[model samples]
Target chain A: MGVSVLQPGLATTVQDVGRPGYYNVGIPPSGSLDQYSSLAANLLVGNAEDAAVLECTYMGPELRFGSPATVAVTGADLPPLLGGEPRPAWESFAVGAGEVLSFDYLRSGARAYVAVSGGFDVPAVLGSRSTYALGSLGGLEGRALVAGDELPIGDAGGAAPGRSVPEALRSTHPRHREIRVMMGLYDHRLTDGGRRTFAEATWRLTTLADRTGMRYRGATLEFRERVAPFGAGSDPSNIVDAPYPIGSIQVPGGVEPIVLHRDAVSGGGYVMVATVISADMDDVAQSAPNNTTRFVEVDLRPGRRARRRRAARLEALREALA
Target chain B: MSGAGGPGAERAPTVAIRSPLPGVFYRRPSPDFDPFVEVGSPVEPDTTGALFELMKQFFEVPAGTTGTIAAVAVADAEMVDAGQVLFTVRGS
Candidate 1:
C-alpha cells in the first residue's frame, strides 16, 4: 500500500543517487544534496543504495501510512515522530497502518532524508528517480509533495526495525566549517590579493542557497583588469561561456561567490576561481544560512586520498550495519 | 505563576512564540518597511510578528495565540535556531 500526505513540509521531494551522463544535453544531475546521508538511510532500510527517498528541507512533512512498514530518518537533526511520540533519527522504526508520521522542528543541518522499508515507487526518468523540479523531469510528477498526494511504496525485502548507523560513522553539522578546494580553473583571473582573500577570509553563507547553487558573502574579490576578448562580456569576471562542473566556485561582478551544486546548470559564462573537492561536497550541502566557511587549498593527490577515505567510511558503515 | 488581582482574578500568563525552523529572523519584511509588531501591540491568533529567511525564501511567523506583545526576544537580522523564542505575549 501507499502513504498519504497529510501536510507537505517546506520543500519535500523524492531523490536518489542522481542521473548522470545527461549534462551534455543541459540536464543537471539532480540528486540528494548529501549523498552519504541518502545512502545511509537506504542501507538502513534494506533497500538498494540508490533507492529513492523523500528529501525534506529545513522543515519536514506529515504523512499517514496505508499499511505496516519499516521507516528510517537520516540527515539533519530533524526529529521524527510516530503517533505523536518522539522517535530516534538514523534508526529504523515500525509504523502501523493508518499511523501518522511527523517531525519536530529541525535542530541542525539543512535537509533530512526519509527512507521507507521498500523505497518510494516512483517511475524513473532518464534512468533516475531523482527530482529536477526546475526542468520538470523526474520524481513524483516532477514537483514537490503536496497535501492529499499519495506516494506509492515498493515491496519490502526483509528490512527490520532498530537498525542504526554507529555514532562514530555519523556526520555532524557545525556552525562554522572549513571546506577544501583545488585552485585551478580561472584562478589567474583574480589578483594575488584576491586569491589570498579567497583562501584566508571567512565567508558567510547567504540566504540565496538551494540545490542549484550556494552563495556566500564576505570580502569582495578583485579581478585582474583585462580587456574584453571577443565573445566574452565586458565585466572582468566574465569568460566565454564554459562548462560548469559540480562544486565549482564562480564569482560574478567580483561580489558574491557561488558554488554550483547537484542541480546546477551545465554551462555558464562566469569565471570560476576554484572547485570544492568531491570529498567535501556533503559538508557544503549541510551548511545552513548564516554559517561561516573558510576555503583551504589542496593538490590533486591529497584530494584523491580524501575521496578514498570517504569511500572507506561508507564501507565501514555498511560493515557495521551488517 | 500568578500575580494577585482584585476579586480572585490572576495576572495573565505569558506565552512564548518560537520559530518553526532555523534561519535569520527579521523584524521587518524588508529594510525599508516598519517592523510587523512591537511591544504592547495587540495581536490575533493569525497575526504575523516576524519573518524567517531560509534559502532566499521568507516564511511568516504567525502568532499562534491571541495576545498583546509583551517582549521581543530577537533583534533584526539575527540568526536563530529552530524552536528559539522570538516573542513573548500576554494573553488578553
Candidate 2:
C-alpha cells in the first residue's frame, strides 16, 4: 500500500539530506533544496531526518493514498488539501485509505517538502534516494513523478497527527530578501565599481532557476581588464575550469549572476565572485522568480555564527518535536 | 493596477482574478503568441487567463469563473505578487 500519483506536480522528486562526500567524483550532493524544512517534515512524521521525502516545486501533485499514513507538508506556503479540504502546513496530519491529497497554488517560497509516515520507500542510489534528474541517478527511476506512478511507502510508524512546528521556528519567505555572502574566490577580478554595485544593487531572480542553479538580473558587473590566460577563455569572466562550491555566485558575460545549488556541476569555467553563506543557502533556495535579493557581504566570523544559529534552530525543532 | 473604484469609479459588478503564485506574469504565453484574454473577450472557468514563469516553470492561471474580460489589471511581463489581482471580469 502506497501513494498513487493521479496528476504529478510540476517537479515532484524524492530527496533527503543528500549524497555527500561525492562531489570530487563529479556527483553533486543532490537533495532537498531546503534541508531544514525537509528535516522538520521528516521529524514531525516520526521518521529519521534523512528519510526520503517528496520535494514539490511550484505546483503539487494529486495523489490517492492506498493506505492510512501520517503526512506533513513543510517549506513553501503551498497548502495541502485532503479530499479537497484544506490542511495546514508545517503540521502533521492523517490521510485515510483511498483519500486523495492535492495542493493549492504556491502562496510563497519556491519549494515544498512532503513527508509521509514511513517516507517514500524508494531504492537509494549512492546511499541516497535523492534525485539528480540531470544524470538520471536516484529517486523513482531517477526523474520527476508522472501520472500512474505508484510510490512505495516504508513500514508505517507511530507518528501521531496534529504535531506542528512552532511558529517562531518556522521559515518565512518574504518577497525581498537580503542574502549574506562571503566575498573571495574571484573578487579580485571585479572592478571597484563592479564590487560596489554587486554589494549595493538589488538583483531580481530570473525564471532560470532549478535544482542546478538560480540566475538573477539587475545590475551589470564589470571585470578588471586582463590579458587572456592560455588556459582560460577570452571572456573577462572566464577562468580555467575549477571546482565550484555549492552556493557559489558566478556572473557570465558580466550580466546575469547565477548561484549554483545542491545539484550544481562539480566544476565550471565561470568566475565565481562570492559564495552565499552556508546558513543562507536555504534562503537562496526559497527565492522565487522576480523576487529581489540584496547580497550582503560578511566575514567568516559572522558566517560561522549564522551556521551555529541555524544548527541551534534545528536543535530547537528536535526538542519541540521530541 | 486593474481593479474597480478607479478614476471613473465602478459602473458594473466585476470579479477579480488574482495570481495564485508570485512570478513574472505574462499576458501572452510567449512573445509570438496572442494575449490570452482581452477586454470583451468571453471566458469560461477553465480558460487560461495568463501565465506566470516561476523557477523556470510556466504555469497557466485559469480564469476560474465564466465571464467577459472587463479590465486588465497588470501589464505584460509585470512582476506580480501572490493574490495580486490580474484581471477583472464582468459576469455574463
Fnat for every candidate: 0.61, 0.58
For residues A1-322, write the lDDT of model 2, one tens digit per residue: 9999999888899999999999999899999999999999999899987899999987789999999999999998888999999999999999999999999988889899999999998999999999999989999999999999999999846498989999998999998999999997999999999999999999998878899999999989999999978899999999988999999999998899999999999997899999999899999989887789999999999999999999999999999998
Each model's TM-score?
0.94, 0.94
Using alpha carbons, what is the TM-score of model 1?
A: 0.94
Worst 10 residues of 1 chain A by lDDT: A156-165
- Best candidate, TM-score: 1
Candidate 1 residue runs with Cα over 4 Å from true position: A156-158, B1-13, B29-33, B77-79
lDDT tens digits by residue: candidate 1, A26-74: 9999899999999889888888888899999888999999999889999
Record all residue pairs in model 1 with backbone atoms less than 3 Å apart, i.e. clashing.
none
Q: Superposing all C-alpha atoms, what RMSD in Å does each candidate have to the true structure?
A: 2.4, 3.5
Docking class of 2: acceptable
Give the per-residue lDDT digits (tens) of candidate 1, residues B38-74.
Answer: 9878777899999988876889999998767889999
In order of listing, the candidates' clash counts read: 0, 1
